[model samples]
Target: MDVVAFKQFINDQIQLFAEKLGDAKHSSNDGVSLGKLTFYLAVRQSIDKKASEQDMGLVGAFNDTLQALGMVEPGKTFMSKLDT
Candidate 1:
């Protein structure tokens, strides 16, 4: 997916989870914490060797977008299941 689409997808997922956790107003620090927790969990899961191909692809796209936006160093790896 393109960068814009990827961002939208992330936002949508976060919003869905926030709503599920009773953060429909999304005005609480707890909501932010939950979002961060969810994101990290997804990252960890994506880097697992047994992760689905789709999960890996999503994480790769996320890392690529971060690099492209200068949020991460170019060619710097985040999580590599092979390194474990």
Candidate 2:
């Protein structure tokens, strides 16, 4: 999928997650937590109305950060430099 489509997907997921979590970022009120992408809290947190922007920034940043540390490779990570 392209970035546009990818952002739509993430945004949709975020909306669903937000709804399930009651939009609770930090609290003990009661919720299912971050759900599937709990491991990607920061990434999930970075998500916003501007999903396309955030998505592209994150993917590029991840790629560069890993490359700088000599860890770039095809299908190396769940979130690679995916086009979308």
CA RMSD of all predictions: 10.6, 7.2
Q: RMSD (Cα, Å) of candidate 2?
A: 7.2
lDDT of 1 by residue, 1-34 (tens): 4444544555676666666567545555665657
Candidate 1: segments with Cα more than 4 A from true spot = 1-41, 79-84
Give the per-residue lDDT of model 2 (tens digit) for 1-84: 555665577667666666666655544633455543442334544443334564556655776777777777644653444565
Clashing pairs in 2: none
Clashes of 2: 0
Error of 2 at 44 (Å): 6.1
Candidate 1 — worst ten consecutive residues by lDDT sum? 75-84
Q: In candidate 2, what residue range of length 10 has the lowest lDDT sum? A: 35-44
